[model samples]
Target: MTGIDETFAGRKGQASATPGAANVPPAATGARPSETRGVHPDAVAAIMAATHGDPFAVLGPHEVGPGVWEVRAVLPEAKSATLLTGGKRIPFERRHPEGFFVARVETQGRPLYELAVEDWDGSERTRHDPYGFGPSLEQHDIDALREVGSNVTYRILGAQAKAVDGIQGFRFAVWAPNARRVSVVGDFNAWDGRRHPMRLWQNGGVWELFIPGLKAGAHYKFELRGPDGSLLPLKADPVAFAAQKPPETASVLQGTSTPAWHDEKWMATRGEKDPRHVPISIYEVHLGSWARVAEEGNRYLTYKELADRLIPYVKEMGFTHIEMLPITEFPFDGSWGYQPVSLFAPTSRFGTPDDFAAFVDAAHEAGIGIMLDWVPGHFPLDAHGLGQFDGTHLYEHADPRQGFHQDWGTYIYNFGRTEVSTFLAANARFWLEHYHLDGLRVDAVASMLYLDYSRRQGEWIPNRYGGNENLDAIEFLRKTNEATYTHAPGTLTVAEESTSWPGVSHPTYTGGLGFGFKWNMGWMHDTLNFVSKETIHRRYHHHDLTFGLLYAFSENFVLPLSHDEVVHGKGSLLGKMPGDRWQKFANLRAYFGFMWGHPGKKLLFMGGEFGQEKEWNHNQSLDWHLLDDAHHRGVKDLVRDLNHLYLNVPALHARDTEAAGFQWLVADDQDNSVIAWARKGREAGEVAVVVSNFTPVVREGYRIGVPEAGFYREAINSDAERYGGSNVGNMGGVRAEAVPSHGQSHSITLTIPPLATTIFVRED
Candidate 1:
């Protein structure tokens, strides 16, 4: 006697002998000597070792003889076991020293029963055998899992809490094609692998089990044995809907209850309007460090708190949308959600999934959209994650050159694999459909588009065409975009691609990548470089400001001053200016005006609006106290006015993606370091003139061409005294004269303020 038999005695008719065996005859005990004769030896051995691929075939109820029914169970912690069925209790005979129990009944058919067992410590309980339930997934689910573009995988797989045969419990499923055995282990079963082995669906390589007594909120993980019978680490579910707070790596079961959504008006009309033709000014945020409760040990605010506080702030600031960094479950805090491990689970550091949904709903109710910075690029190789899942390179590439990211020290997904690609494509649909998110700004797209990205020669692998392009990744991206657009109509999908890949924001039917918007990385880099120089030196770099227009309308663009520009020792946007304290503030205000007046959408990271003097720190709150200074406060006010003007004026947004929307009136004025441009709307007589003086000397009576002759009101002036600038400008408005200049029939002579950008709209 080794395990359960070591404490409890065995009967005479039982197969295994123990310390206290009752010497009763077969007739007296109503038992036969051949009760365990028909059981297979190999099946018993496999069940004892927890390596049985199909535990249901041998562990559940079965017929051992013509009229004899047998119920078998592996209760390793039990001292005694009894089978209760049809209002009768039959004591089980110990079949092995390792706690294998079997009970034989002379019934006509296999009987349904429950196991009433006493643990080694004298605690007694009864449980419905997990193996008694049949497969919970249908044939259609298997087909969908195997299909290439199916977006229903999240609904089919993972721990789904449902009732099967009227028994309320959870049905667990995971894809591990090469695993020798897989089991559902949790606190309910004492984390025992042999207690609940899953049934294997060979069609999709998915292992499923229906635990009859399980409930939601229970933590669990899959215990797997590789194909070679070697036990691997406990792996977290890739499709887990929720997970334990970081540092404790267990997947929490969130039942099938969906959060109540009350954003009917936002959802109903979202798809009717095109984003390119609307005013879209986004406020990028990193939720964790944006604000914290300093009194309570500097803890991150809950999602509800954010909804209560952050939403109102964004609405007041006149931003149309709030773009948050990745909220997916991850292990490291410093990685900032970029190296995510659980793609499906929203990080538990915030409240539950339902709490996050409420936050989005709150934003929508406030007339603001929510966008997530989605990362489908690379994943960290953390133990208990997707790395070496099933003891093989199942989700990632096997070769280091193709599968590994040397720069990030992470594993790259093998987009060539059908299952892997399908998994990622379905994940994109999951967030958009399940959470009612307004948009997804795909991150690190440049890394996905190139095979030799950040790699030197001879250190990388080429595509099948012997080129640097990743063909499979390109196809996967195309498929993902197509699926999202088809399923979640009206939702935006923006790409953070930095290279010159043609037509990145164009239609897929025209051989484009099919992103709704692409970040204007070239404009950000060039404009930042030019503005960082002294005003006297700006003449040589004037092309940097004018060059972006050559391809501005090539794709729909969003001018982003994202968090990447401020962190990693790169200094703050205000600190990047080369001048005195007053001049630095003026330059930032001027650049913001320039960015807002340009021919694209706008996005500004948090703290940039108020001109935070210090660099962004993910571990601490933003320097919000800087707003106490009048200079910083003025910048914030300027941003608010810029957003409102951009929203109210159609000429600034209506034709943003069309070349006809913009015309340069002073593109070659490098010597004066002054440039002017005219913006036009779709309709006639809707036009605005913009002028910028990069130097510190105000130009008196500077002439700017205009398409229409009328009263041009100064809609916004970065040099206004209210924005901490020298109070110099055209008093109220400028009247266009008949003087022809810069190929236009009308022109306006105005006083251009120093280190400022001013906009004048024609009053129709």
Candidate 2:
């Protein structure tokens, strides 16, 4: 379904108030009054119509004469209103029938007072005037927010519970530049837009109000009247730190919580270290489907519960990091947290924002880093969201071709606009600075890099130079990277770019996108295709095995076997093999062994380590019961060993992005479906030789050349019996002799396992 249709039932690209029209208060008496009085006619009209641009000008206390003050209050639900000072009561004149009441204080100005209002139904209540406070947005903040990107927009704009002048309440602010007026409406005022009209900063286009005595957890939305005086639907705050669960679109008032960050050591050293040459084995996970309580109606684990279970599980698996699919607040569970509605708020699916923060803390304490799959290319066009905000294409572009994403039915962010660009850049910094996430893996980067992505020739608009490159998005990405890397030192930004974009992982100052790493999509595609072919046919397609070496060092690449490979009808990684059960298990092990031994970091999606036979289903937990089988358990064990081996051995990880670190021993033994290579560290002796035989034929006395003459101990053999393999290969180790073979002077003549890959480390 289109995102527009998700919130609005009618009126495309226009704000019509039927569902929200009830929020607008009925008009008061139309008699024009003099402006000298505090309760001016314009203020009354605006309050009655709920379109008064600035309520603070007239509603709050104003010194009408020396030592005498005129106090005005608009309680639309009240029948009579009075001002309450300590031990004294001052009555208010009902100026308009729409609950516009006024009172004059003669003693030492307006004095601290509260409003006691009697409703038409004989209900009386007393509360402090919400409009009595002043606007908190300064001119400097507005200029900085509009000019250069600022990271504190969330702190300034959302519903925040704070003590204002010693009065406790929630402060609400939003940016609706073109709106005629805006108001803070919630259950506190019966969703009446006229009850608490906001103070509009004319130049900055920001509306704000502080309601005293209000607490957090109250649901609220900004009720904006369009520039044309047309009432718009109540919108959820874009910078909201918390939100009500989906299907109920309301931003929640958030309370302050001091983060108990115990990861100072992790943060201190993480920035100084270079990840390119280090072993980073990431386990990509979809939190909702990772596990569930089957007996509890398949409910998902809370953030704390996930910390209890997932933290130890990943640490035990020896993975360096856990990459979670976007946990940002999304309206639909099926979007997998991609089409986010609230970027600042962690999804309420698991728990509160603090709950997610706690989860990160727990992971860090366990020595595991966490990465988020951040989606910034586009957002859902839900009416309450940024789409057509203030009855215009404020957040997105005006034209459909430029503004819309056809494939996803979402709204593309107009990165060229300064406010929009700054808002997004700030969001990128929010997660890293607030929740202490280690890195971001930007999703759908190809779509952002190109104008014609997933579109026909006429459906897309080219750049000023008539090129397909999206210059604005490119600039925005650079800005985001600069902000993230600068603000959150030691954090990483990875790109899931599918195209052959140049210098994607290079430094921004050196003319690049500035991501720390890029996903090796070509390697994933080619290798998965090669492994899917029958053993006899694999000989003809040997280039797939050797092709990745051609550009392995092009960027700091991460060899990903991710969720995209196992979802839909693609089947599991184990299920993708073209072999019987035993052969399938062997092929998977061999493929993983090759992957771990390759010249790059590694990523394995959830359940792929255990040889999950079925395709990934986001609605349910993975087939964990399969672990009871020896083959499944064997696959898990192999992954664990691969991670440990990769971390401990410098040859496997160090200099992974340097061409000098790799040397091919045999690249043209395709007839036997065999390929061998050596990985070297910065110096000699830090080397590992890998040999893979794709067929079920054990090649005995296979003379493989090595650089050094020493005892080559078998580090990992995919065909070992412990890994549920046939155990037909090297027993413990092989000794290399001074002989020339495959261009190397030292040669190791040994038994090669069938349909397996093996790693042999030369002893020191």
Candidate 3:
């Protein structure tokens, strides 16, 4: 074996760079363009010999001596030198072609020779080739690896059966190869694992312990000690079914997570699956305050109570889907369900896992789909739970460089670990299988896709030359999407990604992140900003509303007024309007109409459709009293009609059909702030033209284009006096021009109301 060695002459003479040293010519600079500097002939010969004429190859970096190292890795097509690490090879789905570098390594000593590799472009990075050397097998490195890898002896030895099945009165076992003593601590034993020292069975380096009298639903953790009398802290079972509060013990819930569908026969009644026509109106609600603890008490709204009270309310609202905030068990009450502790457990605050399943089933019976908010990118820093799970690094990396996240103040899972991956991927499948939920809305996905997502330099590790391609996280996300789709092909998974991470909603096979739809955060921000501006300002940025339409075709999109926009001083959607209360209501109605009119799926927060005046407070009930007001009543009516129009309009729901069948018949932002558009469909008389005016002045004869040349009638108007606005809408029908112009469009001069939206349809 070759050992790294340095001589006094070599180190003291050529290695030391003089403080004022300038460029000095060597014997031969012929390898100029490639090396950029003179390299020793022997060094060149050694590299070429090591890689066998593969001039592009470089030995990847490895720990050689104290603060020294040699780099060895084949940079087949890299643009620069790459960091390398020890990790299992996994197939990755590629979205855009980019070079992937392994993690950086910090070594002890200087190496005898240094190797550098470079490539012109990212064309050479592929799974079919190797780019770097395996991890160094130095003693310290091996010890570190063994420390992390050995912590989960139960993973390989199969004591995880206890975590899956639970251990009281049941056979529970785990193997800790490095531990001399093992104890099972869990809810079954009142969390006292020491009273019952687990029987230690050793087979080679594998150490096993089996405990009896544990039952499913029993929360469990392990207590281990090495031969050196070093005690390992309590550790959660890797495959727990249930988990203890916030940061401690994992729960081993009884029975399978799968539930038998009570409406199996009902599911077969659907003729053809059309997402557009499937009554897909989603009512986004927060469970904590949908109903409160007064009648339900601090005891909380059980899944049964929500089914009893909420199903009718949702069905009455004409919503066909219910999108819940993150229901996973979270510790902080103030968080709008973002800080999740347990990946598998539905928030116990809402009820048990089975209860959540019943709620989903109840909704299914009521002809509604349920979508859960899933947060997997970051986890809370809970010492009792996932953090330091096995005394040593188990689920996460030991090195602070690999484990911590500064932005979230939480520990991100080492997605590169196979078991960690399986845990996450299985959680995604578990929700779908157990609850029969139709979809999931993945939260904070931008954090999961990038290494430098929210990190500042010196706080985070970098690739060799200090680039920020988070290869592991990217691979994890890819695998997660693929596995989720594989498990349930039609199940919808939406991404709440803010960054322009390409193909987040693309299929997994194509190297995309594989989500069904991405929340149109861009549209939400731009539209909110534009609408909040004065009428004149809207004209200048009218294109802001239309900008998303360009790349919107690449992925399915959902325009959402999510919880983020409602809380923390952002204010409610109605509160964001630029005019009076009436104008505010009208503007909101117009915006919703426009949102539905745009080519995307739509979601309204719990209080949005009804015009709740107050911002969303997670702890309290929505201002249901607002519905009693005459002003808010019109908003509710408009929302109901919007849902009806969405259901009726074929142009709205045709798969992947967005603004293509639409045209801006009129957009004179100055003319009383009126704008109009039409949606065309094959059904001859099914077209609808929408006209809106922001000014209080009613126009007696505002000419707007119609798709057909015939008698046009007002279908719905937001300004009816009984509902709310100034009651300035035209009471009678307006006849269209005899001949059509501008692509079969007919202009009609009719009375239009200010601060109101009107839909005029052709009379058949």
Better of 2 and 3 by TM-score: 2
Tell me the tens digit of each residue's lDDT in model 2 across 1-764.
11101112232311222112222223322323233334446446766777755555456676655676777887778878889876678999878887888888877734688888898889888888875655555666666666434686766778767877788888877888888778888888899988887766555677777888877788888888887889988888898898998788898887545577888888777788788878899999999999999999999999999999999999999999999999888898888999998888888888888888899999999999999999989999788898878878898999878899999999999988888888888888888888889999999999999999999979999999999999999999988898898888888899999989999999899999989899999999999999999999999889999999999998999999999999778999998998789999999999999999999989999999999999999999999999999999999999999888889889999988999889999899999999999998876798899999899889998999998888988999999998899998787888889999999999998798988999988896
For candidate 1, which ten residues in a row score worst on lDDT?
17-26
Q: For residues 152-190, write the lDDT of model 1, one tens digit per residue.
A: 678878898888878888899998988878998887778
Evaluate residue 245 in candidate 1 and report its C-alpha lDDT on the 0 to 100 scale. Answer: 96
Of the candidates numbered 1 and 3, which has the greater TM-score value?
1
Q: What is the alpha-carbon RMSD of candidate 3 to the true structure?
A: 19.7
Off by over 4 Å in 2: 1-38, 108-110, 118-126, 147-149
Listed in order, each prediction's TM-score against the native is 0.94, 0.93, 0.72
| TM-score, structure 1 vs. true | 0.94
**Which rank order by lDDT, best down to worst?**
1, 2, 3
> How much is the lDDT of residue 343 in candidate 3?
62
Question: What digit string (tens of lDDT, one per residue) describes model 3 on residues 593-684?
Answer: 67766667888888888888888888788787777798787788878877777676665555334555567676545535667777666466
lDDT of each: 0.86, 0.84, 0.60
Which order, best to worst by TM-score?
1, 2, 3
When 2 and 3 are scored with lDDT, the better candidate is 2
